[model samples]
Target: MAVHSPTSGPCRSIVVSKLVAPATRRSLENMSRRSGVDLFFSSTLSSAELTDRAAVAVVVPVPHAEDEVMEMVHRIRELAPTILLCGVIDVPDQSLWLFAERNGFNLVSSAGGIGAALSRRLAADDLGVREPIAVLNSSDIAGRLGLLGEFEVEGCSVALWRGGGRLGCLENRCTHSGAKLSEGEVEDGVVTCPRHGSRFDIVSGERVRGPADSDVKHFDVFEREGRVWIVPEP
Candidate 1:
């Protein structure tokens, strides 16, 4: 939801972390009074600037190594507001998403469908309700036999599932190298990465074996009236 600010600026403005061009900073600062959220278009923002401001920052994917990402996550948690991650490619693991959610950062996809939705919402300045919305539903017991649900609850796809009394949610990106985790396989409590031979526990989202040491995000799940909801912990 694009939260329209009652004031002149956006409820927040976006600042690309890695894409923090001098001109871009000038532009954001010039209009800082009106803009509320600062979207770090990519993982370009220097560590120093992310935490001091009260504005929300949207971190995108950068070509950073594992240690770099962990450092960024630590800083992100320190600068808590409302984080929306975009364009994340699944690589060796799903640590970025896991760390963000663990630190209370709202994990949203920067992929095609949900990524576009989140970008549009932020552009429009509307943060309605930070709740999860179901997009895809699965009951096909023969072929896949798993529930596929998209979390557009906040303009991004935070896909979730609850089949056979099991519950799981991920950032919609596979940890094996950027494949959509939602499109992956989940059986007997394991979610198989579509790209490679990686499996994650649906309930805990931990990559149990093979190439993925990072954990996928696990949101708070609830069902009512035959509908499922994924709520981020506050």
Candidate 2:
């Protein structure tokens, strides 16, 4: 949602915590603003800059080391001391993702799917809805699953998938034999079940080929209070 206070002019600006080349920044900013959102960078982001405004979403790239990320989180919380809304993207691995979400970053994801992730989270913030749980970033899951690595989403998996280049949550279980879809291959927007080579469309969860006779489940994901959330089955 593009929101602005009368004094703020256009209020749809995000503060990024890492440094990109100026050219890359300009290109990204130009592309994003066309959608009415602006991208601003501050490698050492200050909370004062964040809280001084009414509605702001802070995007931080998760650092590799556990300690570095924790340090960064603590620093931001300390400086902001007011209400803080935090989110993280481009998490390199699951351990780091857990660490970040546990600390303060409620929105977790990989770089490719961040556009939609930010949009969802920011919209939630505007509505004053804070989720009680911190959903896992499927960025690591995207890498693992795309490589035929093994993972199972016991409850719900919010994936900013590699194939569709979109953010969606799907029950990554094989419709037949209940196998984990992450152990199989994803090609042309379809995820395969390793057990018997069953395949389902990643977007619609429709069964494409089988051993699997049924479609996988898809869930809606949204963000608020610094974390992305999976919409539960009704």
Candidate 3:
């Protein structure tokens, strides 16, 4: 299933592998058409000839064996460390999902869920073009002592905290496994991920511990007229 959309530009490219189901392939193709994304469908992960031009790949293993899945993921990661990886599984299971996450696959989801997930990752850069959203009121955030509150800005989850009389805001998703940082404990200007205990400096969004090699996304926060506002991406 090689689809060349007229809208396919250099901005985004996607390679989909191991999706044998005709319906699944067609669904992804339809999504690519609607979103104007470049779509390349391949039969196997190893055979998929991806170049630096490719941005991400959706991998679906035909076999449910844990070993096979792990091997495929390992191969893909070895071949393309910079390319974002997403796994599409037919059934929802905890063990397999955790295996994918622990191996550094950015997202793992059911076949029915991959289209939306891929779309979100593809459009992530468009956040910079959108307007800043007002998250909460300063008065509403004041007097929280340590953890101020959590809010959503333009569909992006954000966590707010105040330490040493200075307010800080960061993307709620943990850099390690996308856990909600708001659910984790905050201490000494660092927030820990509840899932893996990855700590991040709330002020700079820098990773302070293991398992998270990247920094969490930081949002510019400011107060205007008694309200707190956030620029989703900078």
Best by lDDT: 3
User: What TM-score quantifies how close candidate 2 is to the native fold?
Assistant: 0.43
Write candidate 2's Cα lDDT for 137-192 as tens digits: 43434344343222233455434344644334467666688776766667766776
List the candidates ranked by lDDT, beginning with the highest: 3, 2, 1
Question: What is candidate 1's lDDT per residue for 1-234, written digit by digit as tens?
Answer: 133222235344444445433443444344433443433343435444443233444544533464565455545533432344333433435665554443333443433333444445455545432434443333432233465556554544566655544556666766668777777777776777788868876656667887876877666454333445465633
Q: What's the lDDT of the predicted structure labeled candidate 1?
A: 0.50
Model 3: weakest 10-residue lDDT segment is: 1-10
Whole-model lDDT per candidate: 0.50, 0.54, 0.66
TM-score of each: 0.38, 0.43, 0.48
Best-fitting candidate, scored by TM-score? 3
Ranking of candidates on TM-score, top first: 3, 2, 1
lDDT agreement of model 2 with the native: 0.54
The better-scoring model by TM-score among 1 and 2 is 2
The TM-score of predicted model 3 comes to 0.48
In Å, residue 51's CA in model 1 sits off its true spot by 32
